[model samples]
Target: MYSFTGNGNPTLVGQLSLAAGGIGLNVSQDGKYVCVGGVASANLYVYSINYINTTATQALSNSIVFGNSALGSNYDLNVRGLSGAQIEIDGLVNYDNVN
Candidate 1:
């Protein structure tokens, strides 16, 4: 993650290493949380954003791993509201002979 000043260049704010390959990302409207969806791992990761002084930080808050790994690729993630931590993810799950 990075932050930009009014007249300065983008600065590195925070970073998180995912356990698997990440294919989708979404930030909450309030800028308090971020969601990362994995492709091969078939997992959803949630992180909480915190600010100390002026620098930003991210901490892993939650994660869910789905049983169907084929459904992991090419997904889109978005926050449902501005005040809540709800997320909406939509994608195609490649099942055997099905999409």
Candidate 2:
């Protein structure tokens, strides 16, 4: 995922992989971690993002992990960028736990 302030610029902000059985996902207020949910059940899974390298051929950008338990009923997961935000690929959404 990427984010921009106001102009149509691209900022590789974060990346997320759907849990094996996750459906919906969202970020916390501070943007430090992600909250995921299932499709048929009401469960929220928390994940943390990690950044390794800044300059390199294979620079480590973002990393995440599905939390232990699900936290809320699952819903459709959609990726939406801010004024200048964009995402490569959105994950699957429905009603299930993937962590």
Candidate 3:
């Protein structure tokens, strides 16, 4: 990931890894989630971004040609929220929620 400043130069935020060669990627509109569609390993990795990216979940069990994903992790008051994932593979779409 890279951060952009007014100078128009991009600064490296950090580097993360995927299980296989990345073929497709998407960042959430809110900038909190990142997705990587990979070949070989054929897994869609969903990462939750705060300061460091954590593997929230993995989806799509095939050599993905193209894909997208979402992840959520949050807390407030004394309640803890569950993490979830949504993915759309080459042709099949699936939504999964985890607690």
Candidate 4:
């Protein structure tokens, strides 16, 4: 994702590797999750939004950002072995087969 600064200039912020180039990607209505539907792989990926608050002394004072924090272990359900499940190389999403 590319986020714009206060000046409205875009900057490279983050990325996710999916099973295939996703044609359908969206953030949840509640703004707490990101969803991607993969047609080629027949998969669904749900990612919890991670926001970090920076204090005044930090570079991005009083800002929220996608930090490099790991999701809780259960966030990625693939390891529990959903039947015939496939996980992306990045393992950044909760996996499920939409098909």
**TM agreement with the true structure for every prediction:** 0.31, 0.32, 0.28, 0.40
Off by over 4 Å in 3: 1-22, 51-99
Flag the better candidate by TM-score, 2 or 4.
Answer: 4
Tell me which residue pairs clash in candidate 3.
Answer: none
How far residue 36's Cα lies from its native spot in candidate 1, in Å, is 0.5
* Candidate structures ordered by TM-score, highest first: 4, 2, 1, 3
Clash list (residue pairs), candidate 1: none
Which candidate number maximizes lDDT?
4
Model 1 worst lDDT run, 10 consecutive residues: 90-99
Better model by lDDT: candidate 2 vs candidate 3: 2
**Model 4, backbone clash pairs (residues 3+ apart or across chains), number:** 0
Q: Tell me how far the alpha carbon of residue 61 in candidate 1 is from the true structure, in angstroms, after superposition.
A: 25
* Cα lDDT, all candidates: 0.48, 0.48, 0.46, 0.49
Clashes of 3: 0
Indicate the worst ten consecutive residues by lDDT in candidate 2: 60-69
Name the runs in model 4 displaced over 4 angstroms: 1-22, 62-64, 67-99
Candidate 2 matches the true fold with a TM-score of 0.32
TM-score, candidate 4, is 0.40
Please, what are the lDDT tens digits per residue for candidate 3 over residues 1-99? 555567978665444455445455666655655666667767675564443223556643433112122333231112122355454446433333322
